[model samples]
Target: MAGGFGAIAGLLGRPSREPRLLLVHRLDERDPGDPGDPEDPGAGPPRSLLVTHPRAVPSESRGGHTLALAAPLTRVTNAALAPATNLDQTPLVRASRSMMAGLLSDLDHDGRRFGLGIDDVLLSLLRGIVLEHPDASRTAPPEATTATRLRAFIEARHTDSRLDVAQVARELGISRRQLHRHAPDGGVAAMLAERRLATARDLLAAHRALTVAEVAERSGFGTASRLRAQLARRAGGTPKAIRQAASA
Candidate 1:
């Protein structure tokens, strides 16, 4: 199941009550040949920066590197300058820049009031880099294997009520079994159910004007009864209860 544009727009229109950002900076060279750990006075220091929201951390080494910033777009909603290196010397640099540019463009164009869809942008960038980069074999992220494809499929059809395992498999040109194998245990059906529930929950929490049945239909549940049953089973609350709580 997926969210409708109206539901998504409503979620986007809300104020930035919860703003989180994740900044990841990995050393271009994972295997630097210094056996002595610097902190231990025998091996070299590990190079990485995993910073959380609203926090800026400084690094000691000012080496040429690739940086990925994943944050809620509201914090930096305006067009901002990001550093880019020449990819001709380093192929990964070029791939990273291309991926980032596509994301920034999407943010500039389609973002709602609170922020851009950074999660969707990041997912799209990762998928493109993994599938299209020439040297993907050398530096591709490990999680880029199945999760990326699954995410791409979901994002592509996040608004379509008819999206199911069969439809997804047909579009991706893979077998149903292959799609299930790509997903975690309990497989595609379970994943789809979870996504639908999450979308419904977001809408319920944010949109006071929408009815329970409207949210259900918008989030891709076939009928209000089915939505109610699923919400009760998964959330331990009725749709009406959830909506009331949200309003309260």
Candidate 2:
């Protein structure tokens, strides 16, 4: 989230907020992305930012913002901006990228209101990428905590109403202690409930005819009454009200 759009409107839409135009060149992890000796970050011609998403950002480097998103990064050739080149596309890669774009679109980046559900979607994509390129995946360092990984694991299976932390821990090959050590602000249960609620709202907004009962079932709230209870307790509204608000 830049203070203003800057030149990002032509590139990626505020990075944390919108997907970038991969026009002139595609982003690569190897691109030279150092903040330089004194961190002179200004909006320059062809400004490059790096996500290094999910990696632990240093505490001191955050400046004043609670969350800091580095600029976008792109590959270069011969010390010059590289031109776009053709590359092979696969369904796995395409689906991974498409989900990422959708997830980015759904989050409120400028407001810094990134919900756990979005991280759930992101971690799943990361694991999928590991499968896509086992060689490169093995070379990178693993995330220090399993909190985000748990989000992905639970999200991929959240539709199964029976999902519990214990089962998730066992499947992920980690102890429950590790799971809760770096849990999100409200912890796992809260994250799951929020995720389900988000899904329910999306279903309602997209399908005008979908009844509360249907949304509840698909979103894994199991029963309509349970869904209603959670929605009332957490969202302060009924399913119909949420649906209307979303569509509005």
Q: By TM-score, how accurate is candidate 1?
A: 0.44
- Each candidate's TM vs. the true structure? 0.44, 0.46
lDDT of 1 at 1: 8
User: Model 1 over residues 72-92: C-alpha lDDT tens digits?
Assistant: 422222111122111122344
Give the TM-score comparing model 2 with the true structure, all chains together. Answer: 0.46
Q: For residues 19-122, what per-residue lDDT tens digits would candidate 2 score against the true structure?
A: 22231112221123444444544322222212233222222222231111222221100011112222224444455444544444556555445544554454
What's the CA RMSD of model 2 in angstroms? Answer: 13.2
Q: Which candidate is the best by lDDT?
A: 1
lDDT score for residue 16 of model 1: 64
Cα lDDT of all candidates, in order?
0.52, 0.50
Candidate 1 backbone overlaps, count: 7
